[model samples]
Target: MNTVLTLMLVAPLLSAALAFAVRRHDQLRDALTLAGLGTAAGASGVMFATVAADGPFVLRVGGWHPELGIVLVADRFAALVLPVALAIIFVVELFAIGQRKTAWGSNPELSGPMMGVLTAGVSLAMLTGDLFTLFVAFELILVSSYVLLTHQGQAAQLRAGMTYVVMNLLASTLFLFGLAYVYAATGTVNLALLTERIPELPDGVRLGIGAWFFVVFGTKAAVFPLFSWLPDSYPTAPTTITAVFAGLLTKIGIYAMIRFHTLMGMDQLGNTMLIIAGVTMIVGALGALAQSHVKRILSFHIISQIGYMLMGLGLFTAAGTAGAILFLVHHMPVKTVLFLVGGLIENDQGTGRLDRTGGLARRRPLIAALFAVPALSLAGLPPFSGFVAKFAVISAGIEARATPWVVLALVAGALTLLSMTKIWLGVFWGADPDRVSVRRPPGNRPMMLAATGIAVAGTLTISALAGPLFDLSVDAAEDLRDPEIYRTAVLR
Candidate 1:
């Protein structure tokens, strides 16, 4: 188990180091990235199966016991999501390979190293245990993301990256402040221990600490009012980087929120999630509708979809929690592929705006098809992974008699369809007389093939494996709901 954990963390860092050393050799950098991501994905798959069958797996770093040192634990929830993260990295790296020259051409100094660091940061975030270590992982992700976001070295990228850095730095400060409070109150930073100990704190102190923690995590997760930074910052990064961030970074924040809610028990903060989830759905959808830029529109929808997950968390039932977990697994890969495809569109058309692009169906039928599958799936069409995941959450909502939230979710889904249709109609369908026509490059097919294959394969995987996957999600939710298993595994 320790070996697995070490491999997961070290592979990407080693790849990053190699990439830095071989920055001038584009082929070498690309090959190293592919190998690193492939290894991570393979390890994640094996670990997922291992945890699914044998229950939670724990590894204490440097052979230090869990209480005094860092512990890495994989339960059903972590196992399920970790593989999805790895898959996203794999797909995004493939897309990056296609766009490497364009991406690196923009900023030769930062692209390769930043990407490697970003990959390692995401893996570290997924694997860390205690709250303090989680904080360190979170900063690693933020700093790397800031660098990646500004990779272009353009004025807009710099400004957006700076805003992103400041907002997250402030969020990190709040998170640390909250952790200090929790540690002062409970005398421990171990998350599993905090789970058992948090309930014993005085109601007022618990509520205060919980609210502070929620604010910090909520900002990271882009919940409603705190989500302003996301739409602004995400679109300014290079498309492949944006795709990776869209798929993984925000999900990590949501992962933390769910973990904390389950471990600490949501009694004090459940209603807060309830209200925020509703607002996040409505507001996020409205934001998407208001955007005409493809990436910006997708960025807004990320927030809206996040609401679905929060709704599940707010329900506080086994079924609802399971739905949220399943949704997380489904959303990560699908969204990454969509964003990569969006990048392909931008690369070909020289823009991501719907108004300026048209006739893609006739000119680039493959890219058009790639765009359609995920777009429709994202709209929750039946027989697709999105539909299954959304159905689970909506059904859970109805079962819990949360009619208002169900209604909001339904409206949000409709708005999502509307927004997706707008993209299809403006970019893929109909003729545009205003835009200059461009010839398709021969190499475009392979890029489109890779992107489409990932999107389609992920959709099929979720649809075909829905039963067992749902079971895994439920098992994860159960582990999360009762932290004794995780605590015992990690602490012993």
Candidate 2:
């Protein structure tokens, strides 16, 4: 089990090194990239299964003991998110293989190799059991994303990368300073140790530290006031890059918030989180309503949908937290596929502006069908994962007597459907961009469609398997609510 976890981390970095080493051979580089991501995804599945069957598996690097060594713990939450993260990277990597001409660059190896580094970073963020390791993993993700965002060498891309780079650096600084304060006050940075020590601190001290956690993670999660960086940045990158970032990156911040909320005993701050969650959803959805471009609309929805996840956390009950976890897992692939479908639209007509793209329904019925699944799913339509996930959150909110927030969520869901309707009508039915209908080109069309297929199928499968997944989420939520379980697993 330890070997599986370690391999999940090392395989990607090793493949990244190999990618650059054999950059001259495109076929070899592609093979290495695919194998690397596949290996990580496989290991993630094993880790999840092992944890489910035998409890968490932990490893201490350098034989330095838990306090001073590298601690990696694969508990239930880590098990769940890591596989999703790796699976996403795998799908995007495979899709990029057929899209190398413009989607990648003159050398596709550069972009694909960076993905390897990113997989390691995301895996580490999920698996590492300490603050410093988490910070380092975040830095790894940031570095790779900078390259990916600007891979096209376009001025717009560089500008977008610059914005992300500057803002993320500040976030990282805040995180470091916060970690320093946490360590200085508690004398240890290990998550398990902090879990034991945080609850023993004075109220004022705890409030101060918890506030820092909120701001630091709020920026990453794209929570309301702190989400200004997402909308513009996502649209400026390549579509696949945008899709990958949309799916996997922001969720890390949400994951951190989930991790520490219980460890730090965040009950005192529950009301404040609820307010933030409300504003985040409304603002994000309304922002989407105002957008003309498909990517920008989807980008705004990202912030809006995050509000739903935060709602779960703010309620902070077993059911509430479980609902939030389910929302997170459901949104990841659904959102990514939506963005990919948008990319396909942009590919067909050379624009994502709804006003510019019309009659796709008649021109490409299959593409429209593909878009409809995740679109309706994202809008909380029935029988899709979104509907089930939202039902959980709303039910939990009502149970907690959070009537106001639940009302706001209902309004936001309506607005979300409106936005989706606008896209459907404008892009698919409004007008045909060409004088005559045209089928999508052969190049990269199949690959892009296949990516969307995976996302849709996975989402529907989750919906079909909602009972088991909700059970898993309940277990994860319980583990989170009782940090003692996690602390004992790691410290023992």
Candidate 3:
């Protein structure tokens, strides 16, 4: 009777409905959104502790037979991930509570109700025990994101939304086909049951399904050859929306890939992700170097960072999975902090265009410091969360003797450093003849301050808690390496 997991899943949904009904009241909507997210955070934390203490918890919807019903799982990995996603969503929502003024009132771009559904969908995607249920969650997120993407009513945004919609629709279709394949082959859609049945299938069928899973998740993950949609779509959204998307969505896709590979006999696909990892990293880093806008640079870096996580998953060892988990945890905070700070810069400076900006360091040390900390961390500087993440990944790659991918990852890291340096020098380091400082409204500054402060603090806390956090990730990876643990928990 894991009440925490159940509440964590359902609260945001109820809150979403309530928030939408009262859309005319800005303060009420904000309060409802914050309250819902706060409750979800508390619930997810309790679930994490419960998972560690009591093992995996499963709830079968409607109390039907496992094969006939939907299921939600609160496993070691889900326990760890749900809170991270929720935290970012909360911070981004706080940021939006001010900047977003909809026709309704406060949520011009991302209404409180939409954010609630988005967070709920993320949690559901993490917790669902079957592909069909995950598909439903995906639909929820897709609908929420599309509305927000077109919020600005810009031609560029509309264009970006089309690409995003087309690609994800294709991915969703692939997910349905993949789900059908599993049901046809195994007679059950339950992940636990599939875990039990998959090993008996022919090797060719397994490989074909593996390929399909990659195409489906790779598009979602924004891995290369299917990656163009992300840089276009993400940068066009409102800053808060873009920050949330950068921090959570693609990580969910990577999470799906890692889970599928480890649990469902798609370890054969590890090498495929390995090749894609190196290419995605190099290409993305190069793209970051080419960008002048702060948002676009960060957008490209998302692709580059994903490659590092893929490297971890590709190695297919506990050490590798551990690296992936830690890197994922590390990247979420860093990415959110970067985007919040970037948006703050644009809000005050009249643009996020680096070429038009200068002299922030001398003029606004706080904003400068915010950017500098995560910037160095993003480049994998030591004593930061990013260092912990990158080292874990590179060490695992070296141990596996994946020399080519290792070299490419190192090169990507160097390029990440170079790109950050470019932004620093362009936007903050050099002298501005105008000597422009952050001149944002004092009222609006609270939102920027709150969002960036909380994000960077979380990033620092990751470093402070690295040993314990890394151990938790190791425990989660242990479960991934041995799916029998997951299977037994639900089936029994």
lDDT, candidates in the order shown = 0.82, 0.87, 0.85
Tens-digit lDDT track for model 2 on 1-492?
878988999999999999879977988998998899899999999888989999878888776777888899888888877888788888877667766664322237588899899999999998998989999999999899888888778887777778888888999999999998998899999988888888899988888999898998889899989998899799987777888899988999999898888666788888899999999999999999999999999999999999999999999888999999999889998998898888778777778888778999998898899899889989999989999899999999999999999999999999999999999998999767754322334356687678778877887888898888889988988888888898888888
Return the top candidate by TM-score: 2
**Where is the poorest 10-residue window by lDDT in model 3?**
101-110
TM-score of every candidate: 0.96, 0.97, 0.96
Question: What is the TM-score (0 to 1) of candidate 3?
Answer: 0.96
Q: How many clashing pairs does model 3 include?
A: 3
Worst window of 10 by summed lDDT in candidate 2: 434-443
Write down the worst ten-residue block by lDDT for model 1.
100-109
Best-performing candidate as measured by lDDT: 2
TM-score of 1: 0.96
lDDT by residue (294-343, candidate 3, tens digit) is 99999999999999999999899889999999999999889988988888
- Model 3 RMSD, rounded to 1 decimal: 2.1
Error of 3 at 447 (Å): 3.1
Ranking by lDDT: 2, 3, 1
**Over the full model, what C-alpha lDDT does candidate 1 score relative to the true structure?**
0.82
